[model samples]
Target: MGRKSNQQFVQIPLAKLKERIKQLCGIYGIRYVETEEANTSCASYLDGDSLPKYGEKPDGWKASGKRIKRGLYRSKDGSLINSDLNGSSNILRKVARNLGIDLSRLGRRCLTSVRRIRLWATKSNLTLKNARAFTPGS
Candidate 1:
């Protein structure tokens, strides 16, 4: 049999992809406002609605910052309690520990990467993944 030749593929523009990524990131408390253009667009989008300001900062930005900070802090502390590991820098290590895996067996070099940390935070079924974002009323 011959391979089908009528298959078609659609190409999405980078700008469109970026916009979609920005939207998804927003839902996960990641602000893509580091650049001037992004900041302007974000500001405009936010101003268009009467959304309640949780504080002097946007909830998403604050949450992302908190997670980063927690992760870094946990990396420094040997203790890995659920609260401490909520958004700690060594989240993968914490998760492994929580699961009763021996870190020594895995070797110190086998800790999870940042990308994996994000994946765990966003997709893992672990209890730590259920930690609420540091937002008001959360």
Candidate 2:
């Protein structure tokens, strides 16, 4: 049994974050297509010889001021990945905002936080799909 005070809750699903990430990347011509070098077993890419699709990135790609490994700018996509792993939070709020999600009750840790995302999608006449990550597949 749960407390009456905690009757309402919110949580962002992985599928939503995945779709939103793709939408944001799509704005810059970045495709979520996977690269051949990605590890099929783990569903993630390996630091291999080939350049990854959507540029999962590999050696020889000269990085700028950002290290391309952990720099926030280089890892803007990290916002998506992190959110996918951590669920809804302030980071998801930022990423969602970038994708025009326009959620008002962001940064709250609950089991029903996805309402605003759905609402925004509805109000904006947007059709959301289960978007894939910038990851490669078998």
Strongest candidate by TM-score: 1
**Candidate 1 lDDT tens digits, 1-138:** 334643455566989888899999899986454222122111211112222233444555421112133333222234222223332323333245445544343322223333233333234455554555544696
- Global Cα lDDT for candidate 2: 0.36
Cα-based TM-score, every candidate: 0.23, 0.21
In angstroms, the error of model 1 at 72 is 29
Model 1: residues with Cα > 4 Å off, grouped in runs: 1-7, 33-108, 111-126, 129-138
Question: What would the per-residue lDDT of candidate 2 be over residues 16-41, giving only the tens digit for each residue?
Answer: 88889889889988746422322121
lDDT of each prediction vs. the true structure? 0.36, 0.36
lDDT of 2 at 122: 53
Q: List the residue pairs that clash in candidate 1.
A: 70-88, 71-87, 71-88, 71-89
Q: Which segments of candidate 2 are over 4 A away from where they belong?
A: 1-86, 105-117, 121-138
